[model samples]
Target chain A: MKIGIIGATGKSGSKIVTEALNRGHQVTALVRNKDKATKLFGGTVTIIAKDAFDITKQDLTNLDVVIDAFSVPLGKHLAYQHIDLAVHLVHLLRETETPRLVFILGAGSLQTDDGLLLDQLKKIPDSQAWIDTPESQTHELDFLRTVTNVNWVGVSPAASFVDGPKTDYALGKDHVLYDANQKSEVSTGTMAVAILDELENPSVHQARFTIRNK
Target chain B: MKIGIIGATGKSGSKIVTEALNRGHQVTALVRNKDKATKLFGGTVTIIAKDAFDITKQDLTNLDVVIDAFSVPLGKHLAYQHIDLAVHLVHLLRETETPRLVFILGAGSLQTDDGLLLDQLKKIPDSQAWIDTPESQTHELDFLRTVTNVNWVGVSPAASFVDGPKTDYALGKDHVLYDANQKSEVSTGTMAVAILDELENPSVHQARFTIRNK
Candidate 1:
């Protein structure tokens, strides 16, 4: 399968690229910094140097799947881009079902025993600095729910998303998943694996799912 | 004030153009059909012929307010354009307080004593044909509510929006308004007046309001 990964040089994006390549799939790295993408993936992947907002339908029509792993640094006042870029991509892909879109959402949208995880996050001391990203991603999922004609799905990580190797993963829908030890965490490698498996097997559609390391 | 109306030749849009011009404000008619716009507001208003999606930030930066009266014909498959165009315009105007936006939304999003008016709209007999318009407009309001950086306000008319001259109007926030006669209705002229009044007075920032005939 031909796969395109937006923000292919970022944390989860880079890992998804490697995982797709290791599975013998053709990978296209859509990145703003060609130099950084080339340094990260070298000659193994195709690189399209453009901002996520500038990616056109022509660039995506040839692929079987596109993973939106785009992220922004916290406290930059640029968090709204999460929702904006999702809308842009969905608008471009309306009335089509070929290139499946996988939006890497945030855990704040996940349901907790109390209300949303976002409600708890808002209560964290000084959470105002980085709360906008998760809040906007929650809105992103809300917007996606209204879309019916597009073939899109959302994947959210657990409360503690960190950098590590793959492990046995547990998957759930719309809720905060936890391991037996009560740890709600997922590594980038596990996320990449779960996303790839879902892409190949195709279970969830038009809804979001969450992943946690076992 | 310099005002731009996106659907300057349509029902509510034409009335808005007339009302703005009557108030001695400079009006720019932004329409897709140049001939229709010229025929509607010949010599009285400036015209920019372009699709709402094609409108750019540079085109809007000069205007004090841009009224998004864009609408699709009922029963057409183009209802999603409501949310899509709103997202596009909001994305362009992000981080700028200038060019305050007034969105002409549908009454489906207004609150009833039971729940959303959209819930009642869904129960109408054989409503599948035209329900998409209101459904998508409701989603459009949902998307706009998430946006905090943009200076945008939404206006929803009453249950039966019709063609008529101006009338004394009553306003309410987030709920369906009813006249003393127990009828929920509003004329295009009344909607136009309420919108222009809101735009001039600079009230109701980043929120939604509904209007009905008194």
Candidate 2:
């Protein structure tokens, strides 16, 4: 299958691109800088360099799937770009079934036994400096929930999302997933594997699911 | 004050444009067709011909306010355009106070004694034909409520919005407004006056308000 990965030079995006290529699927790296993408992928993938907002429906018509791994820095402004870009892509694909969308959202929206994960995150010391990204991503999912005509799926990582390699992982819907050790964590590679597996098999539709390293 | 009215050729937009001009304010009609705007306003207002989605922050930089009176037909595709356009405009004006954005929302989002006004509208027989517009507008307000960075305001009319001459009206926030006769209605003229009155006085900020003929 053909795949397009937005923010293909970012941490999660690069992993997803590598995993997709290893799976023998054709990959297109949709990034803002062709030089960076070419350096990273080394001609292993097609590169479309432009702002994600400038990507048109025509550019996505031929792909089988588009993974939105776009992420903003933790402690800067423009966190609202998460929701803005999601709305932009959703608007472009309204009522279309082909070229399914896979959005990587934060775990802030997950429901916990006590309350929302975001509620707990907000209670953390010094969380205000970077809380807008999760809050905006929550709004992104809220906006996506209202869209019934699009073929889209959302994935949320565990509470302690970090950098690592793939491992045995468990999948659940709308909850902060925890492993047997009561640890809630997922690696970028683990997320990539789970997302690629789902994109290839196609289980979820217009719904959000979560993953954690088991 | 110099103002920009999107969908300036529509029922609500036309009325608002006329009211603004009559009040001796400079108005710029941001419309899709120069001919339609010229025919309606007789070149009384400056015209910027473009789709509402294509409207940019540069086009709005000089204005004191922007009234998004953009509306789609009752029962056709692109009903989602309402929410889409709102997101687009709000996205362009984030973190800015200049050109305060005013959204002309639908009455469906109003709270009622039972639940939301949209919940009742959804149960109406044959409402499936035109319910998408209200549903999208409701989503539009829901989306707006999460936005805190943008200087914005939203206005919803009474349950029965119609076209007529100006009249005295009362204002409320959130709930569906009703007159002494228990009739829920507002003419385009009355809505125009209430909206312009709010714009000029700058009472409501970062919130939604409703109005009905007194």
Candidate 3:
């Protein structure tokens, strides 16, 4: 399948690109920095260097799937870009089912005993600096829920998302999943595998699913 | 004040353009049809012919206020454009305080004795034909509420938005308002006056207000 990954040079995005290529699927890295993408992928993947906001329908028409792994740096005041980019992409893809969109969301949107994980994050000391990232992503999921005509799905990581290799994973809908050891976390590799598995098999639609290392 | 009105050729939008012109403010008709706008206002208002989605921030930077009076016709399958266009305008104006945005929303988002007016609208027989308009507008308001950095406000007319001249009007926040004789309606003229008054006085901020004939 032809796959386009926005923010393909980012942490989780690079892993997804590698996983997709290893599976023999064609990959297109949609990034703002062509030099960085070429350096990272080393001519293994096609690169379209354009800001996410400037990506047009013509650029996405040939792809079977598009993964939105776009992120703003934590502690920056530009976290609202998460929600803005999501809305831009969704608006461009309205009334179509092809080129399925997969949004990589944050764990803050997951359900917890004390309501949303975002509610707890707000209580942490000095969370104001980075809280907007999760809050904007939470709003992104909420906006996606109202959309019915678009073929889109959201994925949320567990409380701790870190860089690591693949592992056996557990999946839950809307909730914060805990492993047997009472840890709620997922690695970049596990997330990539779970996302590719879901894309190939196609289970969830217009809703969010969470993953944790099991 | 210089003001821009999207959909200035439409029913309520035309009235707004007239009211703004009457108040001696320079009005620009940011419309899709230049001929139609020219036929409506002739040389009275400057016209920028472009799709609402294609409207850019550069075109809006000079205006003191931009009224989003864009609408899709009833019973059309393109009702989702309401939410899409709202998101587009808000995204363009993010992180800015200039060019206050006034969104002309639907009453379906207003609260009623039974949950929301949208819930009641959904129960009407054969409403499927026109329900998408209200449903999408409701979602538009939901999306706007999450935006914090933009200087935006929403105005919803009463249950029966009709074509007539301006009259005595009363305002309420969030809830559906009714007139003394139990009619829930507002003339396009009243809506225009109320909107112009609000734009001039700047009473509401980052919230929605409803109006009815009193």
DockQ of each: 0.84, 0.89, 0.73
lDDT of 1 by residue, B1-214 (tens): 9999999999999999999999999999999999998888889999999878889899999999999999999999999999999999999999999899989999999999999999899999999989999999999999999889999999999999999999999999899998778799999999999998988897799999999998
How many collisions per candidate? 0, 0, 0
Per-residue CA lDDT of model 2 for B78-184, tens digit only, reads 88999999999998899999889999999999999989999999999999999999999999999999988889999999999999999999999999987778899
Candidate with best TM-score? 3
TM-score of chain A of each: 0.99, 0.98, 0.99
Q: CA RMSD for every model? A: 1.0, 1.1, 0.8
Prediction 3 TM-score vs. true = 0.99
Which residue pairs does candidate 1 place in steric collision?
none
lDDT per residue as tens, model 2, A1-214? 9999999999899999989999999999999989999999998999999999888999999999999999889877888999999999998889899899999999999999988899999999999999998999999999999998889999999998898999989999998988778899999999999999998788998999999998
Instruction: State what share of the real interface contacts each candidate retains.
Output: 0.73, 0.87, 0.53
Better of 1 and 2 by DockQ: 2
Model 2, position B16, has a per-residue lDDT of 94
lDDT of 3 by residue, A68-88 (tens): 999989988888899889988
Q: Which stretches of candidate 1 lie over 4 Å from their true place?
A: none
Query: lDDT-based ranking, best first?
Result: 1, 3, 2
The TM-score obtained by model 2 is 0.98
The list of candidate 2 runs beyond 4 A from truth reads none
